[model samples]
Target: DCEFLGIVGRNGSGKSTLLKLLSKIYTPTKGDIEIDGSLVPFIELGVGFNPELTGRENVYLNGAMLGFSNQEMDAMYDDIVKFAELPEFMDQKLKNYSSGMQVRLAFSIAIRARGDILILDEVLAVGDAAFQKKCNDYFASLHGKQTVILVTHSMENVMAYCDRAILIEKGKIIEEGEPAKITEAYLKLFNLNS
Candidate 1:
């Protein structure tokens, strides 16, 4: 079923590992995963970007990696640029763009990819406060309408956006339940009273 699920844990607690496993970037050593439909993983920003290539070229390149054709990328190009708010910089080489600019572009492209499931890792922490709010709004629009598996450290995000959540520790799921309860449990581990 389509749902918003949050995964939370301390650093190096396998939250990202799980997302990578789901995204097929890392094959589990001893497990199987069954996904029912298409998935898009916004795991690492600027993953397929070429430092030598212009942002416009990188857009098509990244789109191709996401299984989009040139024609399809052409259709989404304008929207992607608009969302990134980098219309004037699309012709600039990726190496010349700031980290934030690159992240904005990559994130813009990732959200454009249609998928049954979307796996995001730390994307909410990208950009400045205003951009983060935009990300928040985008997730708000997807709540209950699309399947999203988000890995984040923000309890507020878990409570605000996730209906269900899981807490991971040392590479295993230690708890799973309603977002509020799961977040409370997670805080308890850190001696924090939520």
Candidate 2:
């Protein structure tokens, strides 16, 4: 079991597409995918969110979409709000929140959900530097305990967090091995060196 696998590739090189396929957001044109356990995907910002709804309401809505009960959401509510650092703004409509705030709330909710495997796409692109460090710490904490499939372009992130990695190009995996090695090959694709 690959506990933490990072995917790295250039833009439009099918990295996000691969994550989408794994998350069931898109069906593969051909071939099949077999997943052995429950998964949580944080593919896009505000995916299951309604802009007109209050942040508190959206939390419950998102939890429900993830197969969580109201009681479960209630139990996690405080933690989510605290993590997002937006407890005061929970009553406000999501549309009124800044993009950063919206992403923070969405990410907080997503991370709270239980899952055997977590699929993330460009999650590191969210929040400010301080919040990004929080995200880094959170991922660091999950190092050996959780199964994560991450899509990112940052070689530093790949080297820092991943146990294994793959380089995809044109919808096919061209390299797979240690994070450092995969990242090296990814760099060469763009005439850059690690």
Candidate 3:
């Protein structure tokens, strides 16, 4: 299905694979993806960041990686800095930042890119309680406003946030429907087998 939706399941249940397929990071073995425009993927937080580079520099670096020109990134650089809430620390080297700080900056850059579609694969499960809360609030705010696809084992979050969900198992969707019902089915089936 080519719908912007939720992909959910327990570990090793192909949830991440489904996200990769949609992101085209790993193309489907036998299929064609013909999206109308660019689909930016934030599959891994801070994955492309150069540790030696300053956060500000890495902002441009990530923008370039996402195929944006220097001018484009420069235009949105302030917003990115604001969204990440790291105005003063922009000049610091990435390696010197804590893991939580890195995640904050990376997620800020990725989400602010705001491409045609967003495929979030557990990227929000970073930082401490406060940062995680901020991330959750950010995701919550995006509800119904943008086209996004989320994959996480946080059933409560799914139940609270997602409108539709598709349960994946072993590289295929086993169930697709309302979040509450689909999640119940997943847990029930998994419990029976376990």
By lDDT, the best candidate is 1
Residue 70 local lDDT, model 3? 96
Please report how far candidate 3 places residue 49 from its true position, in Å. 0.8
lDDT of each residue in 102-168, candidate 2, tens digit only: 9999999989878899888989878999889999899999988999999998889999999999998
Model 2 residue 92 CA deviation (Å) reads 1.6
- Alpha-carbon deviation at 15 in model 2, angstroms: 1.0
Ranking by lDDT: 1, 2, 3
Window of ten residues with lowest summed lDDT in model 2:
185-194
Clashing pairs in 2: none
For all the candidates, what are their Cα RMSDs to the real structure? 1.9, 1.9, 2.4
Span of ten consecutive residues with least summed lDDT in model 1 = 185-194
Better of 1 and 3 by TM-score: 1
Model 1 Cα lDDT, one tens digit per residue, 1-194:
78999999999999998998888889989969999998888888888899899999999999998889999999999999998999999999999999999999999998988899989898999998988999899989998789999999999999999989999999989999999899889989989622
lDDT of each candidate versus the true structure: 0.91, 0.90, 0.81
* lDDT of predicted model 2: 0.90
TM-score of 1: 0.94
Candidate 3 per-residue lDDT, tens place, 26-112, comes to 877787877666676778877789999999999999988877899999999998898788899999998898877888889888876
